[model samples]
Target: MKIALCVKQVPDTSDIKWTENNTMQREGVESIINPYDIYAIEAALKFKKNYNAEVTVFTMGPLQAVDMLKNIIALGIDRGVVISDRKFAGADTYATGITLSAAIKKELPDFDIILCGQFAIDGDTGQTGPCIANLLNIPQLTFIKDISEYNENSITASRFLDDGIELVKVKCPALLCMLKSDFEPSRALINGIIKAQNSDIKILTFEDLGLNPEDVGLKGSPTYVSKAFRPDIKHSGEKHYCLENNSGAQIIYDKMKEIGVFNG
Candidate 1:
């Protein structure tokens, strides 16, 4: 099995700060690989170890994101491919999916399986994986909790749902959006780290991928953020002292319900 694992680097949500110009102030902010992506990597590694498969990782981000890919390589996977370009900045899910599909086509021509996280923590949209599948014109299973069965020709997986789960069988040359429980990410091995440090990680630019400037990044994005602002704080402590099991409390609750607070 030749698998392609898509990973991404995201900003630390906890330390996200905005600049005076209303954009994210990335300086001094910590960044890490997307947590969900680790599950995808772990799944690919499992296939590599158990089935003697080949796993190649691909990441799309700035040049600095190479650090994350190097760390991924330290998990005993195969080589990593990075796609970074200034023209790819400010891409929404649609643009990102298109760009990644182009890169995947250019890089992994004979790949059989494509794996990605359910969603990125920074974006939280859960759209990129499916969009990539759409761009590739391949069948995809999203929110997959486990790969129940897989071989060179087909794959059976369990898709996570709100109340239950759905079983899906997809043909080869397919894409999957893996959930966190797909597998546990491995720790970096010393030998693997050394090999990763010595490996020549391939870097692809925008033109290298044969992308049109208008087909990516902010210019390619149809959805635009007109304005960004923080939600206003409306809750204020207004606790009233009352006896336990008091009818007054029930009355207040009923009044709040009448005003639609409870319903909302």
Candidate 2:
């Protein structure tokens, strides 16, 4: 079986830079793999261990992301591909989904399954995975927390919902957006490090992916960030303490009435 692991390089939130147009400037920022994507990698690795599946990690980022791909390859993925291009700059989640889907469709047409993190920390929109599935015209399950069974044709897994969890079975050629799991990611050993350094990570550009510049980047993005700024700290909220439960309840009631939470 062949598994496609879709991953991403996200900027460190603590140290962020923005472009003049309110978009993130990622070229020179320090980056790390999305934490949720670690679960996706673990899933692909599990498939490899149990079924001898071939796992390829795919990511979209700037040229520097090549090192990030190497990092993933060090985690036992069979292959790695970095989709990078200057033309792909300033792409929103929608455009990014298009570029990644096009790359996967053309390269891994026979892939049995695609795995991705539920969302990237940088954007946190949680839309890219579903977007890719829609563009590829395949079934997608988001917030998948566990895979109970896997075979050549289908998989049974647990999906997390706001209300509760649901079990689902999906056929091959499906996409799964995975949530973080309890599985601890394995550390890279010396062999993995050596292999990673020697491995040939393939690079795909916009032209290589047969994409038009206008179809990607800001041009294809239907959404725009008009402004981004931290809300001013008007004042710190006050905290109240009551010695008794009844007193606390009474205080809360009075405050609610004062704030118009209670009518009349």
Candidate 3:
């Protein structure tokens, strides 16, 4: 089976900063694989182990993104493809989906399964994966919590919903947007790391993918950030003390009543 996993290099959330243009300040900040993408990688690895599948990971970012690709390759992926070009900068979910769909069509024409995270940490829009599926005109299952069965022909997965889980069976050549669940990510093996270090990464630019300059990046994005600001949050703390007796219980009850937390 040929499986393709889409991943992203996202700014570390712990120390995220915004630029004057209302964009993420990536300079000098740490970058890591989108946490949700790790679960997608894990799912692909599971498929490889169970069915002897070949997995390839794809990302759209700058040259620095090669580092993120190498890390995923170290997790036993067979190859890495980086879609890097200045024209791809400031791409929104729609533009990103178009760019990725073009690349996938060119690179993995016969791919059996495509997997991606339910959403990227930086955007949290959860739109790209489904958008890609729509652009590619393929069946897609989003918010997948578990993949129960798979073969060369089809896949059966457990999808998470607001109320309950739904089991879905889809034909091959489908896309799955995965969510982290009980499965733990595996560490890179020594051999896998060495292999990743030595392997050549494939880089694709906008022109190479036959994309028009106007069809990518900010120009292609229908939405734009009008304003950005952090809301002021206020915090208050209170402490109360009473003797270790019925008075303490009474005091607690009184406080709860005062706060409208208790009526009895």
TM-score of 1: 0.88
lDDT of 3 by residue, 1-264 (tens): 898899999888988787776577768889889989999999999999999999889999999889888888888999999999999999999999989999999899889999999988888999999999999999999999899998658999999999999999999899999997776688999999999999889999987899888888899888888887766576685656555454777777888999899687
After superposition of all CA atoms, the RMSD between model 2 and the true structure is: 4.0
* Total clashing pairs in model 2: 0
TM-score of each: 0.88, 0.85, 0.89
**lDDT assessment of candidate 2:** 0.89
Error of 2 at 35 (Å): 0.6
Worst 10 residues of 1 by lDDT: 237-246
Put down candidate 2 lDDT per residue, 142-180, tens digits, no spaces. 999998899758999999999999999999889999999
Q: Which model is ahead, 1 or 2, in terms of lDDT?
A: 2
- Rate residue 5 of model 2 by lDDT: 92
